[model samples]
Target: MARNRFDIDENLESPFDIKHFRRAMIYIRRQKKPMIVAFLLSALSAAIALSAPLILQHVVDVTIPEKAVGPLFGWSALMLATIVVSVVLATIRSRIMTRVGQDIIFEIRSDLFKHLQQLPFKYYDDRPQGKILIRVVNYVNSVSDVLSNGIINFILEMLNLIFIAAFMFAVDVRLSLITLAGLPVFLGIMLMIKTRQRRAWQAVSNKSSNLNAYLQESISGIGVTQIFSREKRNEGIFTRLAANFRKEWMRALRFNALIPFSVDNLATIVSALIFLVGLLALGPGEATFGVILAMSSYAARFWQPILNLSNLYNSFINAVAYLERIFETLDEPVTVSDVPNAKELPPVKGHVRFDDVTFAYDPGHNILEHLSFDVKAGESIALVGPTGAGKTTVVNLISRFYNLTGGQILVDGHDISQMTLKSLRSQMGIMLQDSFIFSGTIMDNIRYGRLDATEEEVIAAAKTVCADEFIREFEQGYQTEVNERGSKLSQGQRQLISFARTLLADPRILILDEATSSIDAKTERLLQQGLNELLKGRTSFIIAHRLSTVKNCDRIMYVSDKGIAESGSHDELIARRGLYYRLYTAQKMEA
Candidate 1:
């Protein structure tokens, strides 16, 4: 397998449905037994708490009137025992809640990371790296918090509300039902809050993504900013993006804070009205001191539960939106993937044939139109044409980076599409015009081409491309540090290292795309001799501008608008006086 990479595009088209929530719920339900136990424990705890007011009435009405200190001490001991039992149960329930919260957070984060692996390359191409990283890190982290503590608190709050209501009704049914009449109003206010919460959370997500993208773009081009003295201008843009981000954050914060506070007050208001109604419904004689006190305590206990429910609604909205974004990326169809039942490519002699293959990045503009050609095993072919005349496109197709729009390309007489992309590409090697320098030591970059190559083999490969001299000159030699994008090396030197890396792979097929363009004439002359040796017993495709490059090709296929307008050795093409002849003569005249 290739190195593990996390370059998924988080802004993929929304592929979210009810299915993601269903998956998330699977983890939520695992704590069902514990939740049920917690519910019962909380109910008992609330019952014990309600007994406090009742015990007070008992002490006043029964114990004091009896004039017995013995009975008072006995009643006080019972109260102490109830408190102790409730405290223990409450402690156990809290621990269970914590476990459930932690487990759900782990599940959400794990599922999110797993989904990222199946996303397509086009997703990565479309978004900024920073935005994607933030989604994987901060956004996922936030959603996990919503799922964990948010859901646990929500469940416990509902249990608390239910038990408190039951206790109130037991005290005085008429007063309990009448007092509960304001429940509809409480529900209505919470529903309105939920609507605003959804919009606020959505805005927060969008703004976060934007801010991350802006930061990434600014930092990546710090070189350009420093060169043009545009730091002030870039800073202004960043400041504006940050300001907008803060506005979105503040909007979410205000609504979330307002909803919980409003609900707390609403519960308080509801409880106050219930007390007045109870006093009216049960006249002074009918309402005992014990019953009235217990009912009042239940009403106040209702607020904590109500506020928790409101906060739960707010958190769930954010989690759902986050899950939707994650699902969008996961569902994106991988544009390039192995075909079902694809056969592994057998060992090949490196013969390549393009049979009427056609392709275009966009419709109505073919990069290669009905392009057909074949090169014998161990033969060298040069593709000479103006830029974007399908030279690199043809090579890219052969490497299976992009599929052909029409026709078939055969490697060793078998269609490339029928072969496993990995097996087919393993036999080919490429050296591009602009080399990519990955952050590592020089030795690490070279080993990237062939991981199993030995140290001696690596040194030999560098020597083959005449790169060993400069490499040895460095204090660390092969281990010399190469910064990200190979910034430490010159263009010519990077190209030389790329050549050495490719040569070490010992591929059956070799592709050189303007490989010699970056170096000086003296180095080019020296490398031309090395390329001649390397080309032997290998199928070679050379895309070059130097007229001298194709001099030794077995056969030259001169690419042009007309497609392979001329073919033959160097001498034969000059006789034709076509595109190749004209271009060749023009260069000599300029010199």
Candidate 2:
């Protein structure tokens, strides 16, 4: 066998820098009409607030002399209308913003979950499960919060700023300019806060992941802690991690909270400055009492948006960091997908060949090297080896669960990688060392072997594997609930159910990896009989931790610490009196 070679790409990068900002804007654009109306309503509300003094001026300086009630009633009605419109628009704006935030967050969560499942096995091996979960959660919440509030608040503030400036200029341009000039100083303070906040947020994220990892590992390994009597030690470590997380969270909140308060106070001080300037500019008869009152209101309004923009700036930076995290997950390149022009596997005659196969999970170690082997139609082979002798690795390559690093695995003489992954695996049956049963009825687990299999077919498959005997003893027989991962069943029974599942599929090739390692001698004997019947006309690979399980295979390969040290039939291999004979003698001696 020749070593199969292909390129590996390791430079992971985020999909795009701007994915989060665009997601936020999509909502704004979707509700553009309603948002525009809300902006106008907010603007009108500010305008009406400014108009109060103008109306007072008219009543005192012009209307009262005319003794007219008409102007007062008309101005009062206009003010009331603007207030009502603003309230309605504000309500609509809140509802739309909430909808946008939830929808975008939902999209992110769904895609992230799908990506996590699609990632190759090696990815999971390298990353902590708890940390990965925390990243997903933190990114979703941070992005959603910043996006929803930032867009609506920033837009409304800008509109409010525009109206207030217009009103102030109409009444007293000089005072308005003096008040507005002070805003740049507030912006400078916000910029400094933003810089600190970014570092604080990063610390928050790091600590959150660490805390979650600690909690998850402790809970999952509580059995080990109990056995070792290390419960107190584990709890103390967890408490310390949680405390550190709290410290990081508070530090971030302190910075996050300080930016807004400082901006608000600056806006207030600028308003006071405007009041001082207004007093001097509006000396006797130059401006009415009404004009001075209205100028002050406009001056205060002008500073509000500056404060808002400052808050929005801080939010935007944090949201962008979260967006970057989200895009990073989505952007991970799928390494083991089918070739662009891959075709479906044709009907099989059950022949498998490993031609010059060498593989390594990492660049540093070659787990399989030049392992050339063949399985002809209707032949059964056993793989016997100590841990890491590549028993499972050879079978994994044939199943195409992981692409080869340096070899060609063929099914019916066609390169397995050139076939669609679905097509290649559909023709094979696998019973792993650790079986998984979804939460469903016993019949459903068996039916998973072939979705379209009939009820009678399911029963037949179960009977063939000798599972029907105990299955019928259950309260509901085949319909009995398996519970999650078949926890409701005994280990031997779970093994029996998996056997029935594989039988129901009628696969052309079967790979059993330590399939009966957990069953007692009586159950193992029954399973062995059932397996011989099951493999009658198929090419099969069987891995057994116990040598007794390999007695009937036509050819058995003794995979030793070095490599294949011996290969022959049960009788012939025993005659050789080599590694296989010694292992057989040891098992008998123990028994």
Candidate 3:
């Protein structure tokens, strides 16, 4: 089956749906007070701008002709005040909208991060981390302008257009018609541009996601590239991905460039038509100099909004493409969640039972079939198997990492599925082969096992795992910072730190999946002494390739062909001369 990425469908009938646009507006709606203030300020600014032409007309037709100095002075001062008010209002509106836009971006990013935390492991397994990062960082930023400037400006320009047209028609109906004759042509051009630009911007978004994914993968595996001498080959792959991104970016830029050029030419044509009609159609005194000047101003104002809308349309298309990608991720259903009536498990006694359990990571391919096993309280069981024999799968099932497809797993006589995952996993500790060490001071990484652990307790846990001796050798001792993935530390040292962390948790049940594989023989012997004390009263399952590790367990199960083929202690298994005996002999011969 194909993995679900929750990607947007590029074949949607429209470039953008009203429903998606409305959903984006919900973030804007949250800042209702600031939005209201912005709207009012925008209206006031438009009104002030519209009054300029009327004042000019009055000065030319009445005030200047009358030659009354006092009245002329009053009108000039009034026009200057209007200009000052318009500038102030525009500045205030911009500030308010900018704040609102940032707030929306913050909320969306926070919510997306929180949602990702709630999603099941399967969700992340199917999607790339870089793609998820793009949604949180890049895509959210792309829509910032739409919320900050696009919506408000679109509304303001439409209102300006309506008011200007009303004033123009009220002054002279014939001239107003002549001024607007080019509007249909402008609309047709914008419609054509919108369709083509939407697809181009969508391509740009896809290419960006691809480039980010490839870059993240390459950087994370840089060690592999250097070890295998693949630097030149990997560079070729990165170059191709980057080239694809640039190609789509240029396609979108072409449409953006054409929009302004078309609007500018159309504006010029409309102005010329309005001038000719006013001159030829009107006789002397019928069209006064003041009236003609006012009409000319109205004609210019009319096309200005058209130009603004066309530019806004370009931005809207780009923003919507990113918005769709973000929303698609947000809308994915969380598949693994606690049932409504789930209850916390009581204090665990470390007794586990897997009754006829069958499991698979994907459908139709079973890893464990009818697997029944039981471990009494405080028992130590070791699982030994070949590479695909499902030894780790059994440990994962015990911790409920993945739900079983058939039968039941029980912890202390209670069905694990009926218990809250937190309650079940908190009492269990797992230490895997490649133990991940987060970047922080050694003390902090150990404290992650138990957040509220005291400094004294942390030191004691390190000593229990024989890690304190080596830890204190460093200049900073326990205060030493581990670089990303603990790269500064050796593999053996990393395992010792992880051992200290798990020991601090003090779980009732423990799982060690090849936990000692990286440790040198001398350190492994030291670690074994500490392990003996830690495992005394806990139910533990150890999966190890080293036959020596399993020799001391109460019982060893050799897993094969999707089930346990034999179970016995080391001496008994050796006497029986079964699979375990052959494996031990082969290992001894190799050594």
Candidate 4:
């Protein structure tokens, strides 16, 4: 599969469905108690609102003609009290729904984040970081209201329609039927526009996601863009993405506009028809002035609910686009998770073995095919190889970052696959080429590897990696603050801190993939002096292009063509004058 870059829009696999709305109902169902209370309050509020037209009819038909001052005051007071009660109930309902909305957002975000943490590297490799980030943050946020109040409002609006229609029929059947006549027309219009509107909104969501992905990528790589003098090119790309988002947004808005337009016009035409037909067709007794007044009020009230329902339907459509993406993240299979009833691997002595191991990142193209190797406890193994010879893949497999396509890896004679990932990985130290440093003080960064490590232990780890001298030079020593990804520090400084973190773990097995490449020659020489003591009883796997760095290892393996091509001590391999010998001679000539 092509890498999903910032500019690329991933194909949306989820179709529009009632099931998607039901899926959001899962989050809503969790807050059922508050939702029930809020919904009851809304129902009561609507009931109170429905009484207003009746009060108006009574005043116009009886109270005004009688000129009854005391009854008018009483009725007026009752109406005012109902209004106050409705407002209070509405306010309470709003507060409850607001809290419920926030809770749903928190829960969905937490679940998405937790699932993302368990997702394998390939999941990340196949998508833009920005796309993933948007789902967890922005998309989850967008669906919160729809999952909460949207569900409530949808049900409430239906109830309101029922209540309003019943009252209209009670006031006068003839006018009520006239008002009801517009509904089928309104329903037909909605049916005509529904699929097109949903598709348009989905397009808007896609464009928005693409824009967000590119924006995040550009921000993260701003330094590179400036260095390469590609600012204009990036800006041009951003402009196009932004324009596409706006274009899709406007197109969707046009569809959204149709909902209200259809409802409003239908309501107006129906209301006019109600008055004309009632006056012309109905006799004096049937079409009372008070009945016309009440029917007109009911006519407006009825369409209002339909209009609100249409708006809620719009919210649901837009929200499904985001919820689909959110749930998709939550549903992403954890390819590298521990098996059911997986046991914790006991503390290992690092007797590592690869038994007929076959692996492939992509199908039908094995990087390692039926390959095998072994390293006993306290051994230091160095892997030297060409660019794509699976040196990094070997270390990643040892950490169980990816499941093997076939065969098994054993640690201390126990199959690693049977072990819990946390237990296995916690006891092994794997440092990669890019050293990621979190935003925190120097001491906090070093202590991250072993969070329970004491201040003294953290300081010792830093000193062991020769990171102490430069850390002390800072104004606050170990307290010195760093920014995200350690942008405040040099690449070498970040690597040094990373080294300290790895050492603090005090693992039985250590895998360093070009760990010391960033450090200056002088600092590297000093670090090696400390690493010698650190490596005393640990089984180490080192991958470095710098041939000099691996010269002292107990064994050197030239990895290529799916397995080890050469294996021996430095001097022994030199004597053989094979693949390792040629590689060493070539580097020596360059030096």
Candidate 5:
């Protein structure tokens, strides 16, 4: 009644859950035809191997004793043929099983990646990237061999044991019983060791996950570490993580080594006992050399399968630990899936409405409460707010990145929740402060906005945002390779490239959250002319800290405490002398 190491109270199910095993079997079922062929080949190989002792018995007792040269030659040839047949069958079976394993790995990895893409943003927000990567990459690789080679090999070994046991009993039950006297002791030892071995392996897997997470975090933030002169401190942390991993790994290694060592010593002792019993039980007419030789061979064969089974069990335990992690990820609920009967959003005129909408990242702590507002088509509105006033949250709501806690958000009279996410978000263009540039050519990064855009179109879009002049100045021009996150480019240049990319998408609704904050005053003035022309017919929401950015906006709204504190044109708000006026005056004085 001892609790399993893997079981947790929250699971409410056994660690070795039937559902998880059944799901794994679904992947195996895909290659059922090849698996059946491999099974038959394994059986044939085992049968051929089982024939070796019988042929040796015949040669020792009959052919050699009679001095029959013809029969001796024939028996030798038959023995050689059995060896050849066993080798051929084993080789073919191995190839087939390898293919089946690789196929299952491909399918599982593909499905995991596709599922990750479909999962909502909140799912990623709650999990570390390193932990997710370990499940997707390392866990899948660990289970591959067990699915392909472990199960099939274990079955074949069991078949060999059964066949050897049957042959031993047929020859003489008394000797067979004597040869297997050590088996009960061996089984008891194995049972005692298995739980400890499993626990050690599980510890190893957990430590490996932690090591991977730390490495990923440190490498990705190496810049910050270097700038802060914390290289030695970070190295110390890494050494500690590595030491913990090595400690658990050594424990697992000891457990794995003990099984084989015990089995080998037991086999030798058992063989010696079988030989002694054979010698004592033999009489002039009662027993022949053939019987003694055959039983000796069977005793050796018997322990070989047990040894193989032990090793396979060790591997299975380790694999199951990783399998549990993988299945846990696969079972994560997608909380933001589309409605069952959701329809695609048609062409939109860009009118957005928030009616009594309330939202929170967690329960009982609202970020936006009963926020009601409407933006007219083709209007440019600027959101000016103090820090943490939820300006970004409003932009996220407009794009349906998170579901509202209460009420509804609508675009062109259709509730966004009732529309397919793809159809709803495709027509919206967003440009943020930290524009992420993928590792690719400048042209490739820009072309990502519209995958099928022609070269001329890409050039035109860059020109519209004044990104073309600097791009052409580079030696590689449009083909200039950008390092990860545009590390080689200045902040202003990265922002311009992002602008060019979003401009190429030609979205009807645009969201710019401090998009030009990195641009110098002269550059900002130059880009402002192009932006004014681009915003002429599009509905745009701009979140800005600078008063100059909102001065040209049709209306400016001051956001505070999850509600609009003031709303009007820049001039109108200045005349009203409220929160907006005070904020603008402070910025003016700082400038």
Candidate 6:
């Protein structure tokens, strides 16, 4: 399979669909109760606030002209009271929506992370790690406000527009029509900009994702960069990616900027037209001073919501880009999962069989074809092979990391495909070529193998794998903090700790692929001595390039050409002078 590099922008196969918004309704519905409360409070606040203009109209046209001082003061106090009440309600609504926004973010991120964990290794292998991290962390965060407050604000603005229009119509029909005459023109301009704006923002999202992917990859491989003395080259690459992101972001902002500019320009024109038409066209009799004042307030109020709607529309376009990426991750299929009728694997005596197994990472490119092998309950099998000869693939198959293209694998007379993954893998201990160490203390990392293991058991496992000697040299000993990938520990030390971790699991079947490749010969010898008891009654598969390492195994299989070419005890293979004998002799001469 072709793998994607950090610099490559991930292809978005589908165009922006209304379904993205519709799909968001699922997360929005989860917080409907809070949203409903917020909406009601917002509506109430808007309703109370609209009365301020009418009160001003009443004071200007009714009270002052008639010299009604008491009425003027009373209305003034009432207007002030309305302003306070509206502000309080709005504050309450803002608080509720903030909480709802955070909750929506949490749920989205949680779901995205959960789905990511269930995805097969192939899913991760195809994309850059940075791309996955950005979706779970950044993209999810970007859409929280859109999914929560954006939805409620959209509704509130629409309601506000309706209320303002109703008040204007009540004041004067002629002026109301004139005030609204600019809407069609504004909407036409928006329709023209709509596709351009969405496309630009989508570009922005893609550029940002690409930048993040490269940034993360560079950070993780910074040591490699310095070792190769390629800092300037990497810097140039980063500068190029950063420039692309900024360029796309600015382009999207330019389109977004036009929405408000169009709204404001049209609004000022309509406000001027409202006055001219009301005074000149309708005459003084139809347009009273109080009526004119109230209509002016209504016109301003009217355009305010329209401007808000334009901003919200901008937010939607931006958010849809993020939502597309987020939902895409959520929709990734779990290629390897338990069947509907799968059952938990029972405890076994460690009999494993590969029955004519055919497997491939990609279609028509079989790595292992029609291969059959069996190991008895307590036998030690060493797989010896050249690189790229299906050594690691064989071990990965036993763990069921990838689904088989053809054939079946059985453990203790039960098909592994019919077993739950957790139950199946829990009994097997696997140590791969890369001994990954997480960020934590030595004890904590070892305890990860058996969560319930006691401190004494952990120490014993470390001792059994010969890791205790080096661990004790640290000032913190078992408490020594290690960085991720165990950068502070030697390659051999990382392998020893990894070996200790595997032993702590006390697995029925243990697989070590290049388990001691980095360790010095003396340490490897000591480790071999320590493994004697651990291998007793436990089925083990050891893959090593060193012929001497496997000289004592019960059987050695020379794996090549998509199957085992030779299988026998070390002495028998040497006597036969076949592929295994030739390879063993070549290594012995090299030594």
Off by over 4 Å in 6: 1-3
lDDT, candidate 3, at 591 = 92
| Candidate 2 residue pairs that clash | 1-356, 2-356, 4-406, 4-407
How would you encode candidate 2's per-residue C-alpha lDDT over 367-401 as one tens digit per residue? 88777878898899999867888888878888887
Give all TM-scores, in the order shown.
0.81, 0.87, 0.92, 0.98, 0.93, 0.97
> Residue 267 in model 3: shift from native, Å?
1.4
Better of 1 and 3 by lDDT: 3
- Scored by lDDT, the top model is 6
Model 3: runs farther than 4 Å from truth? 1-18, 65-73
The ten-residue window of minimal lDDT in model 1 covers 1-10
lDDT over C-alpha atoms for residue 52 of model 6:
92
What global local distance difference test value does model 1 have? 0.77
- Leading candidate by TM-score: 4
Candidate 6: tens digits of C-alpha lDDT, residues 74-193: 999999999999999999999999999999999999999999999998898788888899999989888999889888888899999999999999988988998999999998989998
- What digit string (tens of lDDT, one per residue) describes model 4 on residues 1-591? 533876666666656567776777788899999999999999999999889889989988999899999999998998998999999999999999999999999988888888889999989888888788888888888889888999889899999999998899888887889998888888898899888888887788788888988888888899999999999998899999999999999999998899999999998998898888888888677787888988999999999999999998888788878877776777678999999999999989989999999999989999998979899999999999899999999999999999999999999999999999999999999888899999999999888979899999998999999999899999999998899999889999999999999999999999999998899999999999999999999999999999999999999999999998899999999999998888889999998
lDDT of 1 by residue, 1-591 (tens): 010121221233454457887776777687778767766777677667657656766786678888989989998998898889889988987787677777766766676576665454445655577666666767666666565556556766787778777777777777576556666877887677776777677767776777787777777778898999998988887787778779978988887788777766676776776667657756678876666666666667766677777777777787776777655555556665678899999988998999998886656777777888888999988888777677777787888777777999999899988888779878998999989879999998888889999999998888888788889999999999999878889898899899989999999999999998888888888888888898899999888888786788888777767357677888888898888899889878988
* Per-residue lDDT of 189 in model 4: 85
Cα error, candidate 4, residue 170 (Å): 1.0
Q: Per-residue alpha-carbon lDDT of model 3 for 287-376, expressed as tens digits?
A: 777888899899889988988888898889899889888788787777555678999999899999989999988899899999998889
Model 2 worst lDDT window (10 residues): 1-10
Per-model C-alpha RMSD:
5.3, 5.1, 2.8, 1.4, 3.6, 1.6
Score each candidate by Cα lDDT.
0.77, 0.75, 0.87, 0.90, 0.87, 0.92
Clashes of each: 0, 4, 0, 0, 0, 0
Candidate 1: stretches off by over 4 Å: 1-12, 25-125, 149-153, 172-175, 193-196, 278-293, 480-482, 520-526, 545-571, 582-591
